[model samples]
Target: MTKTEQFSKLLREMEECGEDEQKQKIEEMKELINEMNTDDFRHVFTKEQFNKFEKMIEEKKISLENAALLLKHVGYCKKLKNIWIDGLKESLLNKRLELIIIAEDEKKKDEKNENLLIDLCECYISLSRGFPPELLSICVPHLLKKALMKGKNEEIQKEVEIVLLALSNIDHYGVNQALYLDEIKEIIQHHQEHHNLTQLAYQSAWLFLSYRLFFNDKSFKEVVANELHFVREAKRELVELTRQVDWMKKEENRGKKEEKELYIFFGWFSSIGNFLINCDLWNEEFAGLICSITRLLRVAKDNYRDIRRWFISILKTAAQKGAAKVDDLLKGGAVEAVLEEILQPAIDGMTEEDCFIFFLNISERLNEKEEDEKEEEERKAAKMEIFEKLEKEGYEDAIFSFHEKLPKAVFHPSFMFVPKNLSDYLMHL
Candidate 1:
């Protein structure tokens, strides 16, 4: 028989095989497909034939191994890969493939189908960059549903990650249209109910939402206001995560679990902070959030260096919420907490840039307060109080000492506009 006939016979045999013979037939099909070159394979399987196999796979008439083998073969041929992706998009749009499958046999079907979904998701992700908007329109909702589905199987978990990663790459406008704020809120709420799923849900939510903010100016402010409820939920989650971190810190045998939890907490906190800053969505509640984060700075001192760095970065970003906001942060004692860390006699693990940025924020806030204050006496008194506080913390000595240790690059001419005294000190260093 010719190659086409042989392949057709193999498929028939595979379909006819009983449970005991299915595995062997799947292996034979995979081996035969592996032996064919792209051109010969493409010549044998027309679009009609390809769709037939796809239908068989979707209908559970073929094993996943056979389905994967067919997909792998399609990927090997350039023309076929393009056709396959187009076909997948069409199938998704036509509802031929159910993206949101509600399996009655959850465990059994999940075990059997998880890898299949993962493979399909990976294929979609690989081909999705700069995809036509129509394709994204068809694919994104399915991806979102997959991302929000909770499964304990490793393959299912991987499928979730791939779905989120794929969603992150689609056109932000497409993503926003496909995943509206209300839908996102529902996913967040669903995941929040399960403690273990919260981090993954927040991480996925952040990745998906960030693209919207990054791409659309109009969507930015709208999302900030509309998604405030989700943001508040994230803050609550962060508080719970911080409590976990604090508890883990006291344990003698803290390992990857503790470290992972810390990273997740930071991810949620930083993402929310960034979203707020990016959209200029500052409010009194955010000021309160900054104050709370500042309290955690001293607590993080004895923890990992990364934890300390992340806390400082969060504070630094919070400080950048303009002059009045910075003043609020300072009034909430952010400066003292930050300065205590910066003025340490022995520098341990913190970077010079973090220290400089913290100080620069303080200086800017001081200058801004001076500029905003109409009365000279009030400005002078405010400046004197800040200076006295700094002096009490040995700020002058710390600046001179840290200046000498800083690299010449830190004093680049680009920074010549820094306050004259600070610039002069850096120059002398």
Candidate 2:
């Protein structure tokens, strides 16, 4: 055995031998290989050394436990030579087909072999890393979707996180996800309630899925805005996040995992919120989105500014695009969040246009006088901070100029009230 293999064997066998016994053995093997990589606890194994170890694995009937551990160790080393690493990977891949068949067979039977499937999935996870992603990635999405489909029954639910971990290692591009988009969405739709899935498991899946959707433009549009109804699912997740946040507010001792899950949800929502602006169909769903996103303001403190940007940009684009409902922005406290939170101390990119168009939309809404006195008062109160902030920022001249430009549109300088009509104009579109 090479020095590296010897070390591996020693580490593997550490539990079985006493420290005294190991010391005597090490003394005898002192000449074997004392070299080490100084920067990290890793070794650059030569092909000859790797071949001998590879041959040992091939010839001997190794336990899955040891093989998995050894593979994990080799994968972690990072300094190993490519050929040697490829040799180990090839061995694992050759062994993988048989395991998959056996796991599939067991999956078909009553009282399926849970431990066997679990161990097999764990081994696959170990083998999932390699170039091209085709080495071990091709069959993973099928297994992941199957696991999710049966997840509610607890049959393959145990393997959900394992499959997620396995798939995450490969599929750098979402080739597998694209191939299985419908099934992916189906499982997501089914699990929207997170019935049997753990918070970690659910968010892990969403993190993976969100990355895929937000990245590829075509898939994203199809998944979210097209007939798929993923838009509604986004709202569902946002609602859950807000619910969890409110619950956390009441609890004295919040679990770190729960807070982590909320962050994951917020991260997902915030990314998707930006993505939603590009979709052609911005409708009532967005109105609900506003409230859900606004509710998350307190919970998303870490990402406050970015989330607020997404909020503002979405409204800005929708206002321009003509599908926006301006009243929802006010009712949802989006105005307050923008002026008080995002524009506070004067963000640079917030030129007069972004602020003016927002006011123009308000003026368009104001011209209609649709809001009764009661609703008007509530809008004023909700935007009081915005009003005060604008006054403090000295936007009176800009407001007067914008109001002069839009005489027909309603303009109340005191509360900076402006009317809508962007969405009204685009409604025909």
**Top lDDT: which candidate number?**
1
List where candidate 1 sits over 4 angstroms from the true fold.
1-119, 122-138, 147-182, 189-197, 225-231, 246-256, 321-324, 345-350, 369-385, 411-414, 423-429
- Candidates' C-alpha lDDT: 0.55, 0.48
TM-score of each: 0.59, 0.49
Per-residue lDDT tens digits of candidate 2, residues 334-353? 55554444334544354334
lDDT of 2: 0.48
Q: Candidate 1 versus the native: TM-score?
A: 0.59
Q: In the order shown, what is each candidate's alpha-carbon RMSD?
A: 11.7, 12.3
